[model samples]
Target: MKEISPKEVEHMLSDGADMNIIDVREAEEVAEGKIPGAVNIPLGLIEFRKQDLDRSKEYVLVCRSGGRSGRAAEYLEGQGYQVVNMTGGMLAWEGNTE
Candidate 1:
Protein backbone atom coordinates (compact mmCIF):
# COMPACT_ATOMS: atom_id res chain seq x y z
CA MET A 1 0.00 0.00 0.00
CA LYS A 2 1.11 3.51 -0.74
CA GLU A 3 1.08 6.52 1.56
CA ILE A 4 -0.02 9.98 0.46
CA SER A 5 -0.01 13.19 2.43
CA PRO A 6 -2.95 15.60 2.68
CA LYS A 7 -1.11 18.16 0.59
CA GLU A 8 -0.63 15.73 -2.28
CA VAL A 9 -4.21 14.52 -2.17
CA GLU A 10 -5.52 18.07 -1.99
CA HIS A 11 -3.35 19.05 -4.94
CA MET A 12 -4.54 16.13 -6.99
CA LEU A 13 -8.15 16.93 -6.26
CA SER A 14 -7.63 20.54 -7.20
CA ASP A 15 -5.82 19.59 -10.39
CA GLY A 16 -8.74 17.34 -11.26
CA ALA A 17 -6.61 14.25 -11.33
CA ASP A 18 -8.57 11.11 -12.14
CA MET A 19 -8.66 9.28 -8.85
CA ASN A 20 -11.00 7.48 -6.48
CA ILE A 21 -11.26 8.60 -2.84
CA ILE A 22 -12.91 6.52 -0.13
CA ASP A 23 -13.66 7.78 3.33
CA VAL A 24 -13.27 4.94 5.81
CA ARG A 25 -14.70 6.99 8.62
CA GLU A 26 -18.14 6.37 10.12
CA ALA A 27 -21.37 7.71 8.62
CA GLU A 28 -21.94 10.26 11.38
CA GLU A 29 -18.45 11.59 10.98
CA VAL A 30 -18.86 11.94 7.24
CA ALA A 31 -22.16 13.69 7.89
CA GLU A 32 -20.16 16.36 9.66
CA GLY A 33 -17.69 16.80 6.78
CA LYS A 34 -15.98 14.95 3.95
CA ILE A 35 -13.91 15.51 0.86
CA PRO A 36 -15.85 16.62 -2.15
CA GLY A 37 -16.96 13.65 -4.21
CA ALA A 38 -15.45 11.10 -1.83
CA VAL A 39 -17.32 7.87 -1.38
CA ASN A 40 -18.55 7.20 2.16
CA ILE A 41 -17.70 3.58 2.78
CA PRO A 42 -16.84 3.15 6.43
CA LEU A 43 -14.14 0.62 7.35
CA GLY A 44 -16.74 -1.85 8.58
CA LEU A 45 -18.44 -1.89 5.21
CA ILE A 46 -15.31 -2.35 3.13
CA GLU A 47 -15.37 -6.12 3.18
CA PHE A 48 -18.87 -6.32 1.71
CA ARG A 49 -18.02 -3.77 -0.91
CA LYS A 50 -14.78 -5.26 -2.10
CA GLN A 51 -16.18 -6.43 -5.40
CA ASP A 52 -18.15 -3.25 -5.81
CA LEU A 53 -15.00 -1.19 -5.42
CA ASP A 54 -13.13 -0.76 -8.63
CA ARG A 55 -9.85 -2.61 -8.86
CA SER A 56 -8.64 -1.02 -12.08
CA LYS A 57 -7.92 2.37 -10.56
CA GLU A 58 -6.09 3.65 -7.54
CA TYR A 59 -8.07 4.28 -4.36
CA VAL A 60 -7.30 6.71 -1.56
CA LEU A 61 -8.55 5.61 1.85
CA VAL A 62 -9.18 8.14 4.61
CA CYS A 63 -10.42 8.15 8.20
CA ARG A 64 -10.67 10.50 11.17
CA SER A 65 -7.04 9.80 11.87
CA GLY A 66 -4.74 7.51 9.86
CA GLY A 67 -5.18 4.17 11.58
CA ARG A 68 -8.34 2.97 9.88
CA SER A 69 -7.18 4.15 6.49
CA GLY A 70 -3.92 2.32 6.99
CA ARG A 71 -5.74 -0.93 7.57
CA ALA A 72 -8.10 -0.26 4.67
CA ALA A 73 -5.19 0.43 2.35
CA GLU A 74 -3.45 -2.75 3.40
CA TYR A 75 -6.56 -4.78 2.75
CA LEU A 76 -7.12 -3.25 -0.67
CA GLU A 77 -3.49 -3.71 -1.57
CA GLY A 78 -3.65 -7.35 -0.60
CA GLN A 79 -6.66 -7.70 -2.85
CA GLY A 80 -4.60 -6.39 -5.79
CA TYR A 81 -6.19 -2.96 -5.76
CA GLN A 82 -3.91 0.04 -6.07
CA VAL A 83 -4.65 1.93 -2.86
CA VAL A 84 -3.00 4.54 -0.67
CA ASN A 85 -3.48 5.52 2.95
CA MET A 86 -4.09 9.24 3.23
CA THR A 87 -1.58 10.22 5.87
CA GLY A 88 -3.04 12.15 8.81
CA GLY A 89 -6.39 11.42 7.26
CA MET A 90 -9.08 14.12 7.51
CA LEU A 91 -7.45 15.81 10.47
CA ALA A 92 -4.66 16.98 8.19
CA TRP A 93 -6.74 17.57 5.12
CA GLU A 94 -6.76 21.14 3.87
CA GLY A 95 -9.33 20.48 1.22
CA ASN A 96 -12.91 21.59 1.61
CA THR A 97 -15.40 19.16 3.10
CA GLU A 98 -19.11 19.47 3.34
Candidate 2:
Protein backbone atom coordinates (compact mmCIF):
# COMPACT_ATOMS: atom_id res chain seq x y z
CA MET A 1 0.00 0.00 0.00
CA LYS A 2 1.07 3.56 -0.66
CA GLU A 3 1.11 6.48 1.78
CA ILE A 4 -0.08 10.08 1.41
CA SER A 5 0.43 13.01 3.72
CA PRO A 6 -2.39 15.09 5.19
CA LYS A 7 -1.26 18.16 3.28
CA GLU A 8 -1.33 16.36 -0.03
CA VAL A 9 -4.75 14.95 0.64
CA GLU A 10 -6.08 18.32 1.69
CA HIS A 11 -4.68 19.95 -1.40
CA MET A 12 -6.15 17.29 -3.60
CA LEU A 13 -9.58 17.80 -2.09
CA SER A 14 -9.40 21.53 -2.48
CA ASP A 15 -8.42 21.06 -6.10
CA GLY A 16 -11.45 18.91 -6.66
CA ALA A 17 -9.58 15.76 -7.44
CA ASP A 18 -11.66 12.69 -8.13
CA MET A 19 -10.87 10.53 -5.16
CA ASN A 20 -12.64 8.71 -2.35
CA ILE A 21 -11.89 9.39 1.33
CA ILE A 22 -12.76 6.71 3.83
CA ASP A 23 -12.44 7.24 7.54
CA VAL A 24 -11.55 4.02 9.31
CA ARG A 25 -12.39 5.47 12.71
CA GLU A 26 -15.30 4.29 14.81
CA ALA A 27 -18.65 6.08 15.06
CA GLU A 28 -17.89 7.83 18.33
CA GLU A 29 -14.60 9.14 17.05
CA VAL A 30 -16.16 10.25 13.80
CA ALA A 31 -18.98 11.96 15.66
CA GLU A 32 -16.42 14.30 17.16
CA GLY A 33 -14.99 15.33 13.78
CA LYS A 34 -13.88 13.99 10.40
CA ILE A 35 -12.43 15.24 7.15
CA PRO A 36 -15.16 16.94 5.19
CA GLY A 37 -16.94 14.64 2.73
CA ALA A 38 -15.24 11.52 4.08
CA VAL A 39 -17.19 8.30 4.41
CA ASN A 40 -16.83 6.43 7.67
CA ILE A 41 -16.42 2.67 7.75
CA PRO A 42 -14.85 1.67 11.02
CA LEU A 43 -11.82 -0.57 10.85
CA GLY A 44 -13.58 -3.43 12.58
CA LEU A 45 -16.27 -3.49 9.92
CA ILE A 46 -13.99 -3.14 6.91
CA GLU A 47 -14.19 -6.77 5.88
CA PHE A 48 -17.97 -6.80 5.94
CA ARG A 49 -18.16 -3.49 4.07
CA LYS A 50 -15.46 -4.21 1.57
CA GLN A 51 -18.03 -4.78 -1.12
CA ASP A 52 -19.21 -1.19 -0.76
CA LEU A 53 -15.94 0.11 -2.11
CA ASP A 54 -15.22 0.27 -5.82
CA ARG A 55 -12.01 -1.34 -6.99
CA SER A 56 -11.82 0.98 -9.98
CA LYS A 57 -11.69 4.11 -7.86
CA GLU A 58 -8.79 5.54 -5.87
CA TYR A 59 -9.26 5.75 -2.13
CA VAL A 60 -7.53 7.23 0.87
CA LEU A 61 -7.98 5.64 4.30
CA VAL A 62 -7.87 7.64 7.51
CA CYS A 63 -8.28 7.11 11.23
CA ARG A 64 -7.61 8.88 14.53
CA SER A 65 -3.96 8.10 14.04
CA GLY A 66 -2.17 6.47 11.12
CA GLY A 67 -2.08 2.90 12.46
CA ARG A 68 -5.58 1.66 11.74
CA SER A 69 -5.77 3.29 8.33
CA GLY A 70 -2.41 1.76 7.44
CA ARG A 71 -3.79 -1.69 8.15
CA ALA A 72 -6.95 -0.90 6.22
CA ALA A 73 -4.91 0.28 3.25
CA GLU A 74 -2.90 -2.93 3.29
CA TYR A 75 -6.02 -5.03 3.32
CA LEU A 76 -7.60 -3.11 0.45
CA GLU A 77 -4.36 -3.21 -1.54
CA GLY A 78 -4.22 -6.95 -1.09
CA GLN A 79 -7.71 -7.19 -2.50
CA GLY A 80 -6.56 -5.29 -5.59
CA TYR A 81 -8.23 -2.03 -4.64
CA GLN A 82 -6.30 1.19 -5.25
CA VAL A 83 -5.79 2.58 -1.77
CA VAL A 84 -3.42 4.83 0.13
CA ASN A 85 -2.93 5.31 3.86
CA MET A 86 -3.29 8.91 4.95
CA THR A 87 -0.19 9.60 7.00
CA GLY A 88 -0.78 10.96 10.51
CA GLY A 89 -4.53 10.49 10.00
CA MET A 90 -6.76 13.08 11.69
CA LEU A 91 -4.04 14.05 14.11
CA ALA A 92 -2.03 15.49 11.27
CA TRP A 93 -4.86 16.71 9.09
CA GLU A 94 -4.92 20.46 8.66
CA GLY A 95 -7.98 20.56 6.47
CA ASN A 96 -11.58 21.37 7.29
CA THR A 97 -13.68 18.76 9.09
CA GLU A 98 -17.34 18.26 9.70
Best by lDDT: 2
Residues 1-98 of candidate 2: C-alpha lDDT, one tens digit per residue: 79999999999889998768999999999999999889999999999999998888999999988999999999989988999999998999888989
lDDT of each: 0.90, 0.93
The TM-score of candidate 2 is 0.96
Candidate 2 wrongly placed segments (more than 4 Å): none
Stretches of model 1 off by over 4 angstroms after superposition: none
- Alpha-carbon lDDT of model 2: 0.93
lDDT score for candidate 1 against the true structure: 0.90
Inter-residue clash pairs, candidate 1? none
Worst 10 residues of 1 by lDDT: 52-61
What shift in Å separates residue 9 of candidate 1 from its native position after superposition?
0.7
